[model samples]
Each structure stands twice: as structure tokens, then as C-alpha cells.
Target: MSGFVVMGITAFAASAYVTLDMSQARPEVHGPAHYGLLVAHIFTGTVAVVAGVSQFWPGLRSRHPRVHRVMGRVYFAAVLPSALLGIVCAQLSFYGLATSGPLTVLSVLWFASAAQGLRTARRRRFGAHRIWMIRGFALTSAAVTGRLWGLLLGGLLPDADGLLVFTTANWLSFVVNLLVAEWWIQSRGYTRALPSEALKPSISSRSAQSSASVA
Candidate 1:
């Protein structure tokens, strides 16, 4: 459900940026990083969307573990360069147009959580992996949300005042995005969730019988 919203938002964000930064005869901002950020965000977000949607398809996953794993690696690889580009681009954000410092912080945190989540998951800590990955993904959605809010508010404000409103509204996306994640984890009662090891099947002789039935 959340992934659907994320995919739509990210695709919109990418398209919006392409219009704003790339397609314009005269761009609003001509910074080199602006173009780079747009490219990174679009490519990586698209990859994430595809891979993420696959997670919901258990039949596909069951039949194609290799495909699933390959996409997982692609997501991880995409995050790294995208995250680095985000950090670089944050500094060039419009001042009074937005708060660069906080955006930079959010980008850094997003990168760390995502990179660490992938690494930990590879090491077999599935529960921790989900936690960190979810945290990272929540931040990923913020990019999309930020642009949406900025556009919405831009329409309400006068041309002269639109930039400020857009900037302020954009940063709120991160706050709102994280708040949604925290609320979801709490609402699902996963805050006190136990270790993955606790869910392992017991080693009784009857375990073979259970496994046979499942197979």
C-alpha cells in the first residue's frame, strides 16, 4: 500500500524535476548538482519502485529467488550513488528558498540507514534489516512528498512569496515522512518486536514431519 503511494510520488517527483531543471530553455537554477540530483533521483527511485513492488508478489519471489536477490542488490547499489548525489545537491538548495542544513542532515541519515540496512541484511539479520530498510525507505519517500507539498503550496502563495512557501513546505515532507513511519511502527506494535532467532522452528524430531507437510 505504502509502496504504491511512494512509486507514484517518486515518479511524479522525477518528472517534475526533469521539467524544472532539465527541459527548461532557461532553468530556474543552473547549478551542476541540480542536474545530477535529478538524474540520480529519477533513476534510483525508479529502480527502487520496481524492486519494492516485487516484494509484494510472493508467488514471483518463491519461483525466482535469483531475480529477487538481483533486484535487491540493484536497490542497494542505486542507493549509494543517489545518496551521495543528494548530499552534494543539498548545499545548492535555494536559500530562503529552503533550509539546506536540515535537508543535508536528512540526506546523510537516509544514506546511512539504507546502506547499513543492506549490509546488515546481507549478514543475515533479517529483523534488523527490515527496521533499518524501512527507516531508509521512509526518507526516500520524503523526496517525493517534499516536491508535492511545494507544488501545492506554491499555487496558494503569490508569485513573489511562492518560493518561500515552496521551500518551507518542501522541508516539511521530511518531518511528515518520518512521523508517518514512526506512527506506523508504533501502531503495528513492532517497537517491542523480538529477534528473528525467536521465530525459528524448534529442533524436535517432529520438525521433519512439519517440514514435509509444508513442502
Candidate 2:
């Protein structure tokens, strides 16, 4: 479980590094508005990678639910803003996919999954909340896999065909990533650190208690 989490985060960090640096170096990669999207994407992506890495340090969060909550809040803060920017950039992407299409569709879906997961967990819907979080995490992994496909396609195809192939490959990567992660969850036994309902109170209580003791 921990390994998977690290792998997922590393992937995102690497992918974002690739995309962000490319966006900076080559004006051709993005349009005027794309520059703004790039900034948001890079900034939020860096936050997520740091937060995700912190999750693995057992003493950092495993022993301290308050710390976990703080980190989770940062993660959500990063994601929500980046997601909105992604919706705009998705419309401007090479595929001509509308903001209402799969590209933007994924952005909305990602936000919804995260929001619903948090909401249900608040309501003590443990299983459903877990499912939604896993789904959201899966969606996030697309950031990584999309870069992998682009790299792979770049090597295989000529420059003229490479960009087209990469775009198509990115679409396939997300579909495949979601399918594989879902399959693993259904067929293989994997569980997160805390149950969703238990997650909220545990963190909030810890935070309150810590603050009270300090006062």
C-alpha cells in the first residue's frame, strides 16, 4: 500500500516536471492562456508531490492524525485550483476536446469524486467514501501515466506524427489506468491507512486535543 502510494506520487512529480519544464522552454507547447494554466499546474503539482511524500513518513502522519488532516487539506487546496485551470487548458489542448468533453469531464469528475469522498466521509459513509477517494487518486495518477505515454510515443513515432500519437496515447493511458486500478481494488485486497468516517473525527479530535493541551 505504501509502495503504491509512493509510486503514484513519484509518477505525478515526474510527469509534472516534464510538462512544466517543457511548457517553460517551448512557447510552441502552449498558447497565451496556456501559460497561466502552466503556472497553476506546476505550483499545485509541486504541493501535491510534497504532501504525498510526507504521507509515507509514518511518524509524520501515521502517528499524528492532526498532521494528516493538515496535509490532506493542503492536498485538496492544491487539487481544486489546479483542476479548474486544467478545465480551461483541456479546452485548448491538441485534441480539440471541449471543456464539456472527456478532458474537462475528467476535471469535473476528479473534483466531484474528491468532494463526494470528503462529504460522505463526513456523514460516516465509510465504504463509499473510500471508493471515491480511491477513484480520485486514480484520476490523479493520470497525470503521471499521460506523461509516460507521451514519452513512449515520442520515441516510436516521427515528429510529425508524434504529437498526434501522444495526445491519443494520453487518452488511452487514463482509461487504462482507471481500469487497472479498479481491477486491482476489486480483485486484489488493498486498503488505505484509515477508514474514511474514522478519518475525520480522528484527525479533528487530535487537532482539538493538541490545541487544548497547548493552551
RMSD of each: 7.5, 9.4
lDDT tens readout by residue for model 2, 164-210:
66556667656786787688667644454335655467877999999
Q: How would you encode candidate 1's per-residue C-alpha lDDT over 1-215 as one tens digit per residue?
A: 66677777766555655554465422244565577565665577667655655654677668988887787777777777777776766676656325666667777877897789788877987667767766777776676677778777777765747656755775687778788877887787665674665577568746897889999
Which ranges of candidate 1 are over 4 A from the true structure?
Answer: 16-27, 31-34, 56-65, 94-97, 155-160, 196-215
Q: How far is candidate 2 from the true structure (C-alpha RMSD, Å)?
A: 9.4
Inter-residue clash pairs, candidate 1: none
Q: What is the C-alpha lDDT of each candidate?
A: 0.69, 0.64
Error of 1 at 205 (Å): 28
Which candidate number has the best lDDT?
A: 1
Q: What's the TM-score of each model vs. the native? A: 0.72, 0.66
Cα TM-score of candidate 2:
0.66
Q: Where's the lowest-lDDT run of ten residues in candidate 1?
A: 20-29
Model 1 gets an lDDT of 0.69
